[model samples]
Target: MKISFLLHNAYGIGGTITTTFNLAQALATVGHTVEIVSVLRHRERPNFQLDPRVGLRPLVDLRQEKEHPQHLRPAKVFPAAEYRYRQYSELTDERIGACLADIDADVVVGTRPGLNVHLALQAPERVARVGQEHLTLDNHPSRLRTALRRAYRRLDVLTTVTEADAAAYRRKMRLPGVRVEALPNSVPDPALPPADGNAKLVVAAGRLVPVKRYDLLIEAFARVVAERPDWRLRIYGKGEEHDRLRALTESLGLSENVFLMGAAAPMEAEWVKGSIGAAASNFEPFGMTIVEAMRCGLPVVSTDCPYGPGEIIEDGVDGRLVPVGDAAAFGAALLELVQDDERRHRMGRSALDNARRFAPGPVVAQAERLMEEAIEARRAGRPVSQDRAPMRQILVGRGYAARDAVHATGSSALRTVRKGRR
Candidate 1:
């Protein structure tokens, strides 16, 4: 089977990029033809190592194509309410549409909401259009949610990283013929041996963004430091919140106890360096870092966030979960593991064993099944009922499709007009 993934950017480092590359490589390893169609490319190569067997095709090269005719114009096909709206434009819409219209693959998966809208509205009827939601529905703006509800009806299958998000979609959105499923992100088993749960370090990694709640983690760690100053916390990742977090650490006199270790790709080494993993996010679509740490035999202590932490970590078993934004509870949870060596080691063993479910073998199997089912459904010519959405929503969705069609048709004329004016 030939599978193609449509990604916003493959050159960058992100959870979506990591998971997509992991799954694509896994598919290639199993003798299937897999390719990644990156919508934009800013760097010479991707930050993460990509398998040589898997092909990469970048549509718009940002390094050289900054002055394209329609590069500055806002995107019409991609929804304006989408978070990455400012990054997309008419040029991207055209490039992505042209690729999908002629793409040769049994399955084409979109990695983000904006790109998913493109795939759902533009991909050929014969191809299986699969959209992967890495973020929960509740996280999206109401306007964006409305847009997705209309556009997603045309999708063959919509997969969320967490089952809770899938349930939300099934209950909130009415996509009659679409198969909504939960497909956890794949994390390849580390090449190094798992951690032995002896280190005094506690590790947390992710973008140093506000939503990650690194401040909360630091506050929680302060409580731990007061009792056991020997234990240290290392946070890896670079983002806008670096200075603020550093200031907070200094203010609390935790400069020595908490260290802001900047971004480290291939965090397996870092995960093994710590005896415990930690996250204090207000929300997580799926806990990729939690699974990564668990794979390295570090039981994570994370906030029991809306969708992911509860699903990934079994409280008092493989890992511990505390209430969101509660530094006291989070600190106590960390202390529970820190104070007990035997229990920590046992939980680490359990974490390593249980995290295997997120390994490539099982995740790729689920992906293959989803793609196969979608293909079979398409081949059988199952009709998608229009009653899936209200008449108003259906018309709005059709308007989106029709507008894009018009944009494609008039591209040459608009370019000619601009050149004449110049």
Candidate 2:
């Protein structure tokens, strides 16, 4: 089988990029031909390690390509309501559309909303269109949700990282025959040895964004320091909230116990250095870092964030889950694991055992099944079909269609002016 993935940018670091690379590598290892089509490349090389077996084809090399006349213009095909809208342009629409039209693959998967829109509306009807939603449906703005409702009808399958999110999509969004399934991200087992459950260190990793609630983690860790002065907390990752978090740490007088470690790639080594994994996010689409920690034999203590931590962690069995935004509860959970060595070790062992379900083998098998079914359905006369009249609304009222029409009008006028000059 031949599979191609449409990505926004593979050069940057994020959960979506890491999970995509893991799945692509697993698919390639299983004797399937796989390729990743990155839409834009600002750096010479990707931040994360990509498998040698998987081919990477980037359409727009921002570092080397000359400025195009349409590079500054807004994208028509890619939905503007998407969060990454500012990064896309008319040049991307032309490039991605051309690539999709001429693509030679049985299946093409999209990793994000904007790229999914391109795959849905532009990809050849013969190829199986699978749109993978890394984030939940409700997280998107109302305008983006409306745009997706209009465009996603063409997709054969739509996958979410969690079953909770998948249910939300199936219940709220009406994509007639599209198969909405839950496909969690795959995480490969670490090469390093598992943590010994003896270290007095607690580790947390992810972007320093507000939704991650790293500040809350810091405040919670202050309680841990008050009880066990020997234990230390380290946070890895850099973002806009770095200085604010550091200031908070100093103000709390947790400067000795808390250390802000910058970003580290291939964090398996770092995971093994600590005995406990921590996540205090108020909202987590899917807790990728939490699974990484578990795979490395460190039981995570995460907040019961919507749609992720609960699904990943079997509370009190493999890991502990506290109420979201409850600093005292979070601190107490960490201290519970900190004071009791036997329970912590037992949970870490359970964590390592349980996290295997998220490993590449099982996750890849599920993905393969989805792709195979989608392909079989496409090859047959049956395809995802629904009446257009019931769903169709005024294009002018829908956000994306209206903007696309305006862009088309401007382009037409420019073409006419160029012809007159000639």
Candidate 3:
């Protein structure tokens, strides 16, 4: 079977790109030919390692392509649905549309909302179009959510990283026949040895964005520092929040202990260096790093975020979960883990065992089975149901209502979720 994945930017180092490559590599290793179609190429080479067997096809090379100077201009057709829509241009629409129209793959899965919209509208009907939701539906802007409820109707399957997000879609959207399922992101076993819970270190990694709430993490880390002065905190990744977070660490007088380790590759090695992994994000769609940390035998101390962390961490067993946005609570959890040697070691071992459920090989195999079923169903002439045509309404009185409240599909009908990602 030939499978192609549509990604926003394969060159970037992110959870989505990392998971996509893992799935592609796993599929290729299992004898299925895989191709990764990157919509935008910003670097000479991808930040993460790619399997030689998986082919890469870049739609737009933004580097130094004199022939396609239009790549430098802004996209006119890029939907307001994406927060980063301004970065795209009219050329992106043409290239993505053309690419979708021409690809001859068995399945073409999209990794983000913008690319998923293209797959819904332009992908060939014979191919199975799967829209992978890497972020929670609640995080989307109202405009984007409306567009998704409409555009995603054409997809044969919509995959969310968590069951909670899947339930949200089933409750809010009215996709009559489209199957909505939760398939967690995969994390391969680390190449390095697992952590032994002896280091006085705590690690957190992600884009340095406000949504990640690194400011809160620094605040919490300050309290942890006062209690355990010997311990160190390392935050890995580069983003716009770098300068602001650096200043915060200085203002709190933790400039020396709390170091901003910018963007480490082969992250598993970094994971194993810490006795405890930390995240204080306001929200996490999948908490991919939690699984990565767990796989390296380090128990996580994370915020019980709405969509992911609560579902990933088994509280007292494998990891500790604190109330969201509470620096005091988050700090207390980290300090408790930092001081207890025996408990930390026990949890770390349990975390490593739990992490096996998300290994790429098994995850991809399950997804491959779903794709095969979809292909067979299509060949059998089962009509893929799409959303109803749009209906506009004018409110003259005190009347406000949620869209599709009555037309929405029941959660029980859509809970055939395959497996937990973390």
Candidate 4:
């Protein structure tokens, strides 16, 4: 079978890019003709490695910056419903439409909500239309949710990374008979040996975004440092929250103990440097780092973030899950594992064994089976009346409008500001 993946940009180094490439490579290894269709290419080549067996195609080359170099202008062909609508243009729409209209693949997979919207509208019914939701349904803004409610009716199947997320989609969206399943992101086992649980280090990774709640982690780590002066914390990845987090670390007298390692490539090597992996995000769709760290044999200590950590880590088994935003609890979990080498090592072993649930073989086979089922269901002309959204928009002509989406974000921000004032 010919399998195609549609992505917003294949050049970036992110969880979605990493997972998509992993699955595409796995499919190719199993003898399927797999291709990645990148909607936009900012660089000459993808940051992540691509398998020789898989085909790579870019629909719009943004390296030279098309008609509007800045891309701050509103979109013409790209649907306004996509979160990054302002970055697209008439050029992107034409290229994507032209490419999808004549594609002959057996299954076309879209990796994000925006690209999924295009797949839903453009892909011929002959091929199974599969949409992968890396983020949780609750994380989506109301505007995007509205658009998805309308657009996803066309998809044969939709997959989420966590069961909690899958349940949310079934309860909130109108997918009718559309099969929604929780398919964890596949992370290949590390080539090197796993962490030995001897290092006095705890590591965390991800873009330094505010939603990651590094502030909470810093505070929690300060408490850990107070108790265990020999232990240190290292945070990987760079982002806008750098200054703020750095300041917090300094003010807490943790500048010497906590180091910010910016965007380390080959994160597996970094994971092995520490005995425990930590993530204190206030909210996470799925904690890819937690799995990556576990794969390298480091027991993870993470917040019981929405929809992910609880599902990935069996509390007190492979790792420990603390309540979100609880510094004392976070610090206590860190200390418990830090103080007890025997238990940490035991959990580390269990972590390595449990992480295989996301191994390439099982994950890819699950995806393949879903694709086959979706194709069969589509071929039978199964009506989606059972779960189609009551208010489906006619997006066959005009692109999704941004007016409502902007208000959705605006209202969310307003609520946050209001809560802060209270």
lDDT of 3 at 147: 86
- Which candidate do you rate higher for lDDT, 1 or 3? 1
lDDT against the true structure, per candidate, is 0.87, 0.87, 0.82, 0.82
- 2 or 4, greater by TM-score: 2
* Model 4 spans > 4 angstroms off: 68-73, 383-422
TM-score of every model versus the real structure: 0.90, 0.90, 0.88, 0.87
lDDT per residue as tens, model 4, 1-422: 89999988899878899899999999899889999998888888788889889899987777665665435455554557666787687677777888888998988998988888888888887888999999878887888898888888889889998767887898889687678876778888589999999999999999899888888888988888888999999999989999999999989999889999999866998999999999998888888999899999999999998878877787787899999989899999999999999999999998897677666755665677678777777788884223321111221112323332221121124335445776
lDDT of 4 at 320: 93
Better of 2 and 3 by TM-score: 2
Candidate 2: where are CA atoms >4 Å away?
384-422
- Which has the higher TM-score value, candidate number 3 or candidate number 4? 3
Q: Compute the lDDT of residue 198 as modeled in candidate 4.
A: 97
- Model 4 per-residue lDDT at 356: 70
Better of 1 and 4 by TM-score: 1
Residue pairs in steric clash, candidate 4? 176-387
lDDT digits (tens) for residues 1-422 of candidate 1: 89999998999978999999999999999889999999999999899999999999899899998778788888999999999998889999999999999999998999999999999999999998889999989899999999999999889989998767888999998888898877888899699999999999999999999999999999999999998999999999999999999999999999989999998989999999999999999988898999999999999999999788877787887899999999999999999999999999999998897677677766676677678778877777873322222222332343433332222222123335445776
Output the lDDT of residue 182, model 3: 76
